[model samples]
Target: MSAYEFPALAIQDWLRVFCYDSYCADAMTSGLTNSKDTVLRWQLAVDTLYRLIASDLLHIPTLKADDLSAQKAAALDYIKSLAHHNPFSSDIEETSHWYLWDISATDRCHRLIEAYGIRDIPQGELSQGLVAALHNLFAENRVAWSDQPLIAVSADS
Candidate 1:
């Protein structure tokens, strides 16, 4: 497979394994009190990352060689797009909104796009870097989730 095809397929496989499979669902929610809420947060994080990767792929062809400004613009564009959302009123919507906001604020995602725009990187190296960055992104999100209060408290109490 070509460089593009490899990352696309790898991302699809990751989505299947983490978002679609029952095993990951169980693992992600296992020690949490608000299991359902936790699951939703995890899914949203994964989905957001997937969207970022897809957007980066789309911008690759437009990237100009040796043009730092174009590369930075692509990265910034990815961050900007991820931050867009309707004003949220409900709990789930609010959760997703902030979740995405937190992700976009991270420098790692920005660097990933910038690195992807580089012209001289070997295809194999690029693919590896993409895969590694994605894995780190997911791991970091998972860690952030784990640091939150696992048990949901009722306001009525």
Candidate 2:
């Protein structure tokens, strides 16, 4: 495709396997207007992968390790914050709400790339595929970076 749009075959395959399968199921159940939770879950999976990459990019500590539960919590909180601030957060037709999270995710990836001046981002046959897919979707980094890192305390806590 475009120059920024990397042809990550592994990621494209993973998206078809993990995200779209559930997305299609949810869309069918609600006449193509599935619940926000359905879309949120998909976006969270994408965001979590990007956040993991960001952790590595910034040399941030990773207490969560491979467990992205904390990242999930932060993502939900970030979405909630978006819903509070953005009037179109509820507009699913515009691909707002959960889908709009890509703006933030992409911006994060672009920032990481600029910060490190990395030409080719690393990828694994297994894990990095998902991150690569996210990078593909949000190819253009439009959103501005924030000074404060996104973090949310789980409801369980």
Candidate 3:
């Protein structure tokens, strides 16, 4: 692990590596790649996040009341926006908005949506679904402050 690498990374990229490894033999990947600034890119690229979770390596942070309230407000507004507006047929368009269209139906995504009350980012790459996705995958400041103790573990986001 390079000194430049942090122990944490964005959840989407982390999950991407997990999926890549889950389906492909040898995951057909280095299982060790991440965005340049992203730590644990190299070693984690090969390992599935499911195993990491099972082994107690990855920890999802729980949001506080304030955070949850904000997320809920955002979500309600987003749902209102989505009313009668389908990505498939809606006039509004954004390319990155729908990457997880199929994956959104997964239990994991549903868990996030339920957990975070996520709606939309309202800023960079903000889409209601992506907001839900981020709720599931992304880490907050608490992730670093998590009570879980990690030692002798290879760094990955």
Measured by lDDT, the strongest candidate is 1
Candidate order by decreasing TM-score = 3, 1, 2
TM-score of each: 0.24, 0.21, 0.26
In candidate 3, what are the lDDT values of residues 29-145, reduced to their tens digit? Answer: 232343453223322322223223322323222212367446434433332232222223233452122221111123454454345433322212323454344434425312232
Model 1: lDDT to the true structure? 0.36
lDDT of each: 0.36, 0.33, 0.31
Find the candidate with the highest TM-score and give its number: 3
> For candidate 1, lDDT tens digit of each residue in 52-128?
43344212233344684576465445333333332122556533433322121124334554575433443323355
What lDDT score is found at residue 18 in candidate 3?
A: 35
The alpha-carbon RMSD values of the candidates against the true structure, listed in the order shown, are 13.6, 14.9, 17.3
Candidate 3: the clashing residue pairs are 31-45, 31-46, 32-41, 32-42, 32-45, 33-41, 40-155, 40-156
Q: How close is candidate 2 to the true structure, as a TM-score?
A: 0.21
Deviation of model 2 at 133, angstroms: 16
Q: lDDT tens string, model 2, 1-157?
A: 2211222443333333332122211222121112355433333333333433343321112223355656545544544443233222345543343333332223444454444333343433333544454444344432112222233212222
